[model samples]
Target chain A: MLSCREVTLLLSESLEHPLKLRERMALKIHLAMCDGCHSFEKQMFSLRGVAKQYVNGLADELIKCEDELPPPPL
Target chain B: MKINLEKSTKTTSEFLHDGEVVEDLRRQMLKFATQQLGDFHLAEDAVQDALIGALKNVTSFGGRAALKTWVFAILKNKIADVLRSKQKTVNVSSLQGAGEEDENEDFMSLFDQKGGWNHDDRPSQWCDPEASLSQKDFWIVFEACLDHLPPKQARIFMMREFIELETDEICEAADITINLLFVTLYRARMRLRECMDMNWYQRSQNHAELS
Candidate 1:
């Protein structure tokens, strides 16, 4: 049996990408029964969304820089 | 199979003609390098160096990873070289060693024994990246918090979370295992969370006093 700590770590990973079906089922079952873990999952999803936005913003700046660059020498 | 030199040359020329491919790759490399070095100039230099090297050795590419990933891998090597050159000039003895550990420990404690954020009462809120940049104070504090992260963790977090690279691609480029990636990312998030929370609290206090 995974401790809450182990489960929480896995929960974070799951938010980043798809988990194996078995792993997903395990997390789902645990979250279904555990309020704390469920809340943790929600928080992880929220954090992921925020982080994605942060990166997208930086990426946009880099893209803008690329647009401003001169065309390569002929 | 007989080698077709003419066909090979034609294919190579056709590949080179795909300007969009090169632009996409350059953008990705610039973003990855910038996030890793935390300096725009250094990142630009690293990307240029990597591109030159790539052009020189384009024949060696086996087409295993995506072109963007390959360019990023080269940029990582270039950044490492840059770091090595810079490391030679820094005096290690002048730095406070114990203070670093204390800071790391303080960050680790924010996660309870269960490895979850200690504060469960407050719900995490999602913010738009483009919108957040409009608030200059948020960007300043966010950038400051980013600076506080250990280099590797900061790079991984920025690449994975910010740049939105796939985990496997990051693992391949950074040459780190999946588990290390997760742990580093977790630590990075914990530190940033603490930094943001503290900044928000201070801002709130200031507003209260002004009122």
Candidate 2:
């Protein structure tokens, strides 16, 4: 049984790299039983989602400005 | 890849008509450079120089990498040059004990002596986190949290997550080892997570209580 601390560490790493099968199984077993770890994992995913949204919004704003600009001179 | 290869035969002159795209690219470069350099004036000069250099070599830009990434690569070099000239060493070692703020303590406190979630500080279920994405103020707070990170951590985090730079590119640009890069990225994400858990989640509770 992986401890919550260990599980959380793996959770973050899973964002960057694919977990080994052993580590993935251990995380799954732990998360299946632990509500706290489950909630923590969900929070991590949510944070990534929100961060992507914010950055994509910036990209969209820049594109919008480009659209509004006057046509380039020949 | 096939489509890009097909389009690569067109000369740069055919695509150079849009001044607006250049202006927008300049703005993006300045913002990204400022994040990394933490100095508006220096960032401005770096972006200006990068823009001129990019324009001079515009014909050499194959349609391989995205335009933003190519411009950013140049800006990265320009910023590095300025930082090198300033003689400001990037002290990764001192980061461990750099401040009295006790960043290590803050992270440690989240875990119990038994290496499990601390009872009091363990995460709670956040309601409709997706709903907050559409709210403009959420990003304002998010960017504020990003800015609050140590400059080096923030710069690397932005390059990796926001700007979508490859790890190899970031490592080469910053001259950091892979271990240091991973550690810096982990610390940055932890800080940002803690910030959102407190500011966004806790604030919602406070607002509900007020109503």
Candidate 3:
């Protein structure tokens, strides 16, 4: 069984590249049983969703950059 | 190139009325251009050319595409032209693995001895995160997190997500290896997710409230 930490790594990596069959199987099985990792997987999708919207509204966004200069580090 | 100024339409009149919008767009364009060109004067020249080009053809902006999108397309072309003339040079010393050891440790700190999540720092469940997209305040906080991302990670993230470049292309553009790109992206995604949750969904008192 893969650790949740390892699973999270694979989960993020899956966005960038296709996982190996073994890695995919492990992640799928882990996600089925692990609620935390499941939530994480969904969050990844949400992140992409917001990112796409941000790009779609890029003009409005960049314009905001003008009203207030980039904010200080959080 | 000879577009008759006489062919102006209602869109042009409305667009011209919003002089403030054009001014805001110019400032934003300059910011983006300065980041890419690394020279204020050069970036100003490029943005000026693009804006002039855009206004000259403002009539062509008839309801087909967004006004900002139209102006940005011209700006992109002008920036590309300048880049071709000046050549690509990105000073990413921060990205060249200067503090990778610290970064690895920071990420690993989220997990435990057996690789389980830490009790205090486990990922929080974000409810109906998609719905946040429709809220105007959401963009404000989200942009805060984006600006807060570590500079190195921010660069790669922007290259991939904002600039919309592929992994291999990013590696070549940043003059980094594939391994480095993957690690950087992983860190960027993880941190960004956590930051958004903390600042928006979690809404801790100390963090900026999404008003």
Candidate 4:
């Protein structure tokens, strides 16, 4: 059985790379029994969601930074 | 000569327009595109397309920043279009060398001698995270948490999450091994997760009790 410490590393790696089959099975079994690891995994996902919003907000700020220049000389 | 906007953006600006203010703004737009697309020629092309698009749509491109920002928005799409087309060809990564970064990042404090989670550091289930997503203050707290990360860890986290770079791409770009990338990212995520829980989740609870 994978420890919570080991599972945390695998969980983060799982976001970046596909885990090997043995690693996957071990993580699954550990997660099924461990509440702490499960919640930690959920937090990782929520962090990704918030990151997207952060990037979108940043881009929107850039787009909204238009100045009130006088209308171009006609 | 390719305008060599590749390295000297100001020279490219000098080639196009003389207004110092407009050139400065053009420099800003060019910098943003280059950071996203990673090549000056492509960035210049995108910037040119954006400028032309803005001018054709609104002939009076005379505004101080109005015209430039509109061009920026268009430039973003152009950069994305370029990235989409170039994503496959961009994978010339070097799978070499073990990086020594993050060798000292031990997570032992959070685990007991038997490897179970420490009582104090064990993660608790978050409450109503979906609702928090729409709250502006939550994002403010999230940004503050990101700001609190160590410099190297912060850079890697941003590349992976915000810029959406692959782990292998990050390994190549940062000159680190796959294992080092995983360790660095794991530390970053742990810190960010803990920070959000403490700053946002628990702080909100305290506020709820106080009110």
State which candidate has the highest TM-score: 3
Q: Write the per-residue lDDT of candidate 3 for residues B87-188, one digit (tens) a residue.
A: 344444534662363365457778898898888776656753333233555667777787677666776776666555667766765667887777787888
The residue pairs in collision within model 4 are none
The 0-to-1 C-alpha lDDT of every candidate, in the order given, reads 0.55, 0.63, 0.66, 0.64
Interface alpha-carbon RMSD, every candidate: 10.2, 9.8, 8.0, 11.0
lDDT of model 1, residue B186:
66
Q: What is candidate 2's CAPRI-style docking category based on DockQ?
A: incorrect
Which regions of candidate 1 are displaced past 4 Å?
A1-3, A33-36, A58-74, B1-33, B38-42, B45-134, B201-203, B207-211
Candidate DockQ values, in order, are 0.14, 0.21, 0.27, 0.27
Candidate 3 - chain A - TM: 0.74
Kindly list the per-residue Cα lDDT of model 4 for residues B1-211, writing each as its tens digit: 5565444234333323556665675677786555455567777888788777655565443333444545555665665555445434332232222223445657788899888999988887766433423355555566577667765677667667756766666665656777788888888888888787787665654422211
True contacts kept of 4: 0.48
Question: Interface RMSD value for candidate 3, one decimal?
Answer: 8.0
Q: Top DockQ: which candidate number? A: 3
Ten contiguous residues minimizing lDDT sum, candidate 1 chain B: B89-98
Per-model TM-score on C-alpha atoms: 0.50, 0.61, 0.73, 0.61
At residue B37, give the lDDT of candidate 4. Answer: 52
| B200: Cα error in model 4, Å | 0.8
